[model samples]
Target: MLTLLHTADWHLGAQLQGWPREAEHRKALRALVALAAERRVDAVIVAGDIFDSLNPSAEAQKLLYDTLKELRAALPAATIVLLAGNHDPAGRIEAPRALFDLVNVAGVGTIARKDGEIDAGVHLLPLRGAGGAIEAHLLAAPYPRAADLPILDGASEGSPVVRSVRALYAELIAAARARIGAAPLVVTGHLHVAGGLESEGAERRILVGGEHAVPSDVFPEDIAYVALGHLHRPQSVGRECVRYSGSLFPLSKTEIDYNHGVTIVAIEGAATTIEHVPLPRPTPCLRIPPRGGLARENVEAALAALGLGPATPADDKPFVHLTVAADGPIVGLDAEIDAIAEKFPIRLASLTVERPPRRETEAPAPAALRLSERQPVELFREAFALTHKSEPTSEHMTLFHAAAAEE
Candidate 1:
């Protein structure tokens, strides 16, 4: 039997609305280490996006190293696999290979090739269990960059990028099949697969040659389990075995409702089962009124109803996103909210106003304009109107023109 703990999209060093997430990350990682120790899994897989940015701060790097050390100490007989995502610096993650080897850690950043052929030795990893016997085989494929994929000459069956991606996996699966006669095969991916739900305003749109999503058929049907990343929502795509572990916590307002956690996979013979292990959120995300926008007149009462006191520690305060109903632009709205917010213990992250419906006599919106047919000024006006429910003022147009000219 082979047991594995799957997690992804840690996004260490990430900040939500200018608020640091180090405290939340630290608490969640500590809990993860404890969970692994308690579960005694044979392997740990971090799919991708370990850091929020390619260039992380020194503290973020320290946090990563410390967490790895803790995992090593907790799971001495297990294999640790870390793959790079689009947000990571591939070479940077693999630079400390020598140091990682000392603690039974495998870091796969990019697909390696030797003499114009895929190098299986670097991408194929062995999962050693009790007495150092190979119990399972793991294909550690990181985010496939444009250069990493094979050059498919005259391949017209599908998108070139998708075909190349599938080709790369097919080669790895073949290599893995030869070594593992009956052992289970696990694969990892850091790309967006079709049908997977994404968190708006949080996940970056990844595209190669205008292709953003790949079909779930990219993975073979016989594979034991596919660990995917890059989507904040934990879900199964195409098959029950193919799943995304999701981010450690809410990274933005759009992700506040996500059940952030890790996945536990147990493989015994031909029977495979998985379980979700949700981690604790040190700081909770709260929305005012909890459903829709609150009327502006009731805003003060809603703020007071949260029951938070001024003595609450800053670290323990919940993140609040306020939605207020507005007829139109209200003067001194920001100032009024700021004064009321000072009395509460929550951290204000964002604010939105729901405008009244447009009149029936108003003309319907025009058909969408293509990039080639749309002017910068016209596009700017449309965007502003969509958000504010009114046309942009002359000052707003002037500012937009100035910005466009500078660009």
Candidate 2:
């Protein structure tokens, strides 16, 4: 049997409303390390979005490396695989490849291929059981672009981008099978499977352009499991064998209530068992006015009801996402809402001021006149009317038009 733990989209260094999320990210990783120790899993897979940005801060880098080190310490015999997501810089993640090797870990950021095929020797690793025997093989396939796919070189085949991706996976899966033909397969990926559920406001829409979301049938039917990333909502695509472990925390207001955590997959022969292990939410995300827009009067009351404001300690401050009611005309009143939040013990992530619906607006007075939409004739008329205290004469207008035509 193979015991595996799947997690993704850490997005370290992410912030809400300009406030740094380093602390929450650190806490989540720490909990994972502890969970790994307790679960006694044989392999751990992290599917992309490791850092919030390509060029991560020094603190985020330190935190990632430090957390991986701790995870290694906690599970010396277990294999750890970290793949790159769309947000990660391939070179950055690949730079520390050697450092991770000392602790039985595999890290991949870019899908670098040579000679029309990926060097499987680096991406495919052995999944061992408690008895020090190989139970399965893990294909650490990270985010791949058109350039990442191998050149077929006159091989007659359908050439859609998704087909190319499927071919790439086939090559990797076949390569792993060559080493151990009978063992189950566990594939790690950072991809969007078609029909997968997404956190509405949390994830980027189509991280991979044009042919981004491939059909879940891309993987062969016989494969034991497919561990995927990119979509923050944890769900299975097409079959239970393929799944997304989701993100570590609520990256935005839309993901505020996600059961954010890791997944444990147990595979024996052809059977598999999947379990979701929810992680601890170090800080709560509070939406001011709960169901409506941000109101100055409700800010303190909402905070107090959430055990925040004067009652909550600074260390446990919640993330505040304020919004103006949709039915009102409160678009320009953001400053007042901001001032109200400033009085509470909260990390102000955003203030969404709702604007009333648009209506036909009348042209402004002379002082507010804009020149972009004004014709030269109209501009001249306005100038003449203003300077002479009267509209321009027909002869003057004719002259202006004649001069305008000549120019």
Candidate 3:
């Protein structure tokens, strides 16, 4: 049996933007490497989105490099293959392929239209490793442009751009299948195949008739297994032979519900069995709402009710949304709010204060008086006059006295 570990969407450079996720990501990576070692898979396939951005920070690069190195040391016998996802810049990712290749790490980012066959006791279709293949024909389909294909029948005429894209992908897939003639053929692609699950924060809507939605029938019928990337959700599309491994870590809050991990596949003869490996130490987040007004007392009470306090910091300074209703007129609410903020590592992403309705017994004050009531102009004038008492002049004193009187 040929055992393969399938994982994707590492998003190594991902940051929670002031939120703490570094530790969780590190934990997830360790779990993945451990899974690979424990399973002793013959090979490992990473679908795509290995890095969150093309130009990741130095810290991110260091983390990825260290993790990959550890994985290599742990699984010296297994072949590790990494495909390029849309989030990664092809050119930049390709630069490191050669260096990794020196250590039995096969990087597919640099190879454009390459095919390879492997012999792991089981006769594989592609013979040549990496870029060049020694099979009847091995086709490697990268992300294809949807605007280069022929138009569909119902597609509006004169929409050559749209039609060509559809036609191009069809031709690409058709051309790929034409070359495979049994012999346990396998194709690896990074495009979104039809009938795959999409995670939150994925590219908005795959093109209506674009390359993202290639029909499952496009793959060769004899193809042993199709390794797919791009989509972050693990799923079997059309046939059991085709599958996505999903992402290795949750990239956003939307993915928190998803079980971040890798898929283990055992390929014996033509049959394949897949098992999902769970990630370790998933990040936990809580969203708390204020029960009453945002007055200092109420805010403290709400915090206590939610079981949150300055003494007990959250596992991660939880993302908090604070809503308060103030009972009476308050002063320096900003400073009081800041004091509350200092208590926990929690960041107030949003703070809302709702004022109670005016009482019928309360008479409406004049606009001037109301403005003065909130911000006393007299206090500012007095402070200014005291500060410049040394330079007092008739004109200055007159201006200061007038300002004080108006207040």
Candidate 4:
């Protein structure tokens, strides 16, 4: 039985912007390694996006190296294949391929041309790098740039650009099939295959009828499975054999709905069975908007609704955004805001203070009273004061004071 653990979009060293979810990311990586070891699969395929940024910090690089080392050691017999995703710089990912090779780990990025037929009872063809000739049952197609394909001589039916790119991709797929001969194959790629899941900020919309859409039929009839990447959501492309493993971690809020995990394919002879092994729960975030009249109570109610209760130092807090209206007279408003800020692990993105419409019966309050009533502006002023206290530069203070005056 040839069992392979298919996982993609590790996105190691990714920061949740200002969100404090770094610990979850670290836990997920460690869990992945453990999963590989526990499954005892023949190989573990990391489809791409190993690093969050091309210019990763030293700590990020070390974390990745250590994870790779642990996986390799834990699964000594398994082949760990790492493919380069769009986020990863091709040259940088390929640089450490050889170093990992010394320890039974195989890395295939944009630059490495590791193509050939491996006859381990079953004919396994590994195709890496841009475009290459394959003569095996399985063909692995890496990230191919638009310019890498052969140019089309004549445009067929539709727009010139669209038709030409389509023809080129068709030719490329055909070439791959012809080279593989009659062996039952599995073609893998890092491109956006058709019929894949797309969440917000997960996939950039492909131009209508662009070359990005590689039809599901491109794979030869003999091919059993097509493992793909690039898209962060895990899904199949029409055919059962063709699938995307998706990213290992939730990169954005859009990915909250997606169950982060890897696909496990069990192949015995000609038949294949697929199963998804889910990852741990991700960090949660809550956004609350308090009602106008009861500002303090509303704030407390929002916190309670999130199950956060009164915040403590030890409690791991969710990223919280509070919105409230503060036109009514409220006691200790500043102190309440400060208390919430200090007590809970909350990030105040915006605090909008809505004012009630003018009433003929109600007399206008004094300017001092009006100033005290404006909570959002006061929040801004408080933020400014906190910021200025640390820096304490004349120019910064002037800017803060000007902003405070406007508030």
Candidate 5:
């Protein structure tokens, strides 16, 4: 049996509303190291989005390097593969290939070509078991870029980009099959697949140009398993063998309820079994009123009911999103809420005010404004007219001027 761990979307060095998430990342990496050691897997595949930014901080790079060293030490015989996602700098991820090879680490940031044809050697790696014999073949594919895809002779049926993406994978898979004969082929991708659930505001749209999603049929039936990334939620797309292990932790308000974890894949002969091993959430994400918005007058009570007190350690404090009902514009509301939050140990990430729906007696909605006629002041005026049914007061214009100046 060939046992492997599949994980992705680390997004290291990410911050939530100005709060650094290094502490949470550290905890997740530690747990991952422990899990790999405990499972004694033959390989570990990190699909993509290793870092939140293309140019990661020195501290973020240090965390990644340290974790790689730990994983290598714990699983000396296992192969560790890393692929670059849309969020990662393709060249930067593979820049340290020389050093990575010393510890049995393989990474693919971009596709390579030789003599105008895809280079198979650079993308294929043989998985060796304890006996030092090849078990399965792993095709380390990364996020496809426009430059990496083949130029078709004529316009294809669906979106050109989608067709190119499918072509790219098909070519790579064919190359792998030709080279390895019929050995169980495992593949890695960092694009959004059709039918995969996405966390809004967390994952970026990667399928660029014409279509935003690539059909899961891109992978052939002969493949043993397909490890994917670029989505924050753990899910199987089209088939049971194709899966996304999901992010190590919640990265945004929309991702708070995700079962953040890694995946375990065991392939024996012709049978394959998959399992999800969830990681612990270090800090809690709390909504002030849980279900709905609370009235402005009761907002303080709702916050207090969370059992929060004075500020705790920055890393330990829970992140809170507060929503309060507004009968009309409340005077000094932000200042009042900030004051109330000062008495709690949580991090107030966002504040939203819910207004009652417009009555039927109000004027009908305004016609759509042309994009060419969009001046900052004119757009603001249109928005204010729609909401208040009146022109902006001089005072409102002054505030708008101040805000616009900052922008």
Candidate 6:
């Protein structure tokens, strides 16, 4: 039996609303390592997006290495594969190749090629069990720039990029199948699959702009499993064999609905079985009054309905997003909410005021603003008035206008 742990989109060192997530991430990584140890898996695959930013903080880098070290220590015989996602700086991710090799951890960021050809030797890996027996073949397909998969002039069926991507994978899979010779096949990648669900707010929209999503048929049906990344919500493509493991934790408020976790895959011969293990939630992420905001009185009444009696420990406080309607008087609004919030054992992560329309025919809010056509000072004045509930003084206007003029 060949059991594997599939997880991705760690986004290590990610910050939400300018709040550092190192502590949460540290706990989560350690938890994953412990989980792997408990499961006694033969392989672990991290699809991609290891760091939140291309230039991650030193602390984030250390956490990743430490997590890998701990996982390896706990599961000495397992093969751990870490690939790069769109957010990763491929070169930086693969920089410690020699060191990783020494520790029995494999890392692939940029696609490896030899003399203008996809180098199967580097991309295709044979998974070995504790008895030194080959269990499966893995194709590590990292996030590819246009340069990685060059298009060829030939009989084509899909868009150039899609054709290119499909061609690349087909070649690698074919190579892997030939090399491994009748073993369970696992393909790992970081891309937006056609039917995958996305986490709305901050999860990177991998298919933004002109780029299109690849159809589910991109991978062969015979493959045992297709592990994916890029999307923050866990979901399968068109079939059960292809799947995304999702991010380790909710990265944005919109992602609260995500049943965050990892997948434990058990493969025997060519058959594959997957179990999604949901993570524990010590603190909750909630958007009060789901549809939208409510009137001040209504909001208070809703809070009362929650019936939270007293404040809890700081670490146990839930992240809250409060939205209130404010067409009428907003006097003592924050104070009133604060009193109610104090009773709820939740941190007010955000407070949004929904204002009623000024007039039935009020000019539609422009979809976007063009600062080049207007003076910067004017924009500042408008924003200041709305935020501070008063017009800017002459001194403020002069200082701001002068600064804008310099630009």
The numbered model that scores best in TM-score is 5
TM-score of 3: 0.64
Give the lowest summed-lDDT range of ten residues in model 5.
Answer: 382-391
Give the Å shift of residue 341 in candidate 6: 6.3
Model 4: residues with Cα > 4 Å off, grouped in runs: 20-22, 111-138, 158-180, 205-212, 285-299, 305-316, 320-342, 346-407
lDDT of 6 by residue, 1-407 (tens): 78899999999888766656776787678888889999998999999999888998889899998998899899988999999998887887889989988877888998788887678878887787667788787898898677677667978665677777788788778778777766789999898888887666665556434465888898988889999989988888899979999888778887878899899998888788988988775366777878678877776677667655575556666677788977544658888888877766667777778876567675554456687877666778777765554578888778887887888
lDDT against true structure, model 4 = 0.61
What are the lDDT figures for the candidates, one per model? 0.86, 0.80, 0.60, 0.61, 0.88, 0.81
User: How high is each candidate's TM-score?
Assistant: 0.88, 0.82, 0.64, 0.68, 0.89, 0.81
Name the runs in model 5 displaced over 4 angstroms. 309-311, 359-363, 366-407
Stretches of candidate 2 exceeding 4 Å from the true structure: 112-114, 151-159, 205-208, 294-296, 309-315, 326-328, 354-407
Give the alpha carbon lDDT tens digit for every residue of 1-407 in model 5: 88899999999889989989999899989999999899999999999999999998999989988999999999999999999998888887899999888888988999988887778988999987666778898999998877888777786578888888888998999888889998988999999999999898777787767476999999988889999999999999999999999999888888888899999999876778999999988788877677668887897788777775565677898999888877554568899999988887888888888777789997777678787978899889877866555678899999999999999
Judged by lDDT, which candidate is best?
5
Q: Name model 3 segments beyond 4 Å from true.
A: 18-20, 110-141, 145-181, 204-211, 287-342, 347-407
Q: Which regions of candidate 1 are displaced past 4 Å?
A: 155-157, 359-407
Where is model 3 poorest over a 10-residue stretch in terms of lDDT? 116-125
As for TM-score, the candidate ahead, 3 or 4, is: 4
| Model 4 vs. true fold: TM | 0.68
Write one digit per residue (lDDT tens) for candidate 4, span 1-407: 57778888777677654444456656777898888778876667777777777787677777778888888788766666777676666677667756866865655554222242221211133422112222224444456554434345754664554444345445445555565555445556776666776776656544334556656665555666777887888888877778888877667655656777899987665787898888875455444552343365567656655555454332245544455655544336657765766655554433444555667785454345465577754555455544332234476557767877886
In model 3, how large is the Cα lDDT of residue 218?
Answer: 64
CA lDDT, candidate 4, residue 305 = 57
- Superposed on all Cα atoms, the candidates' RMSDs to the truth, in angstroms, are 5.1, 8.1, 10.8, 10.1, 4.2, 5.7
By descending lDDT, how would the candidates be arranged? 5, 1, 6, 2, 4, 3
Query: Which 10 consecutive residues of model 2 have the lowest summed lDDT?
Result: 324-333
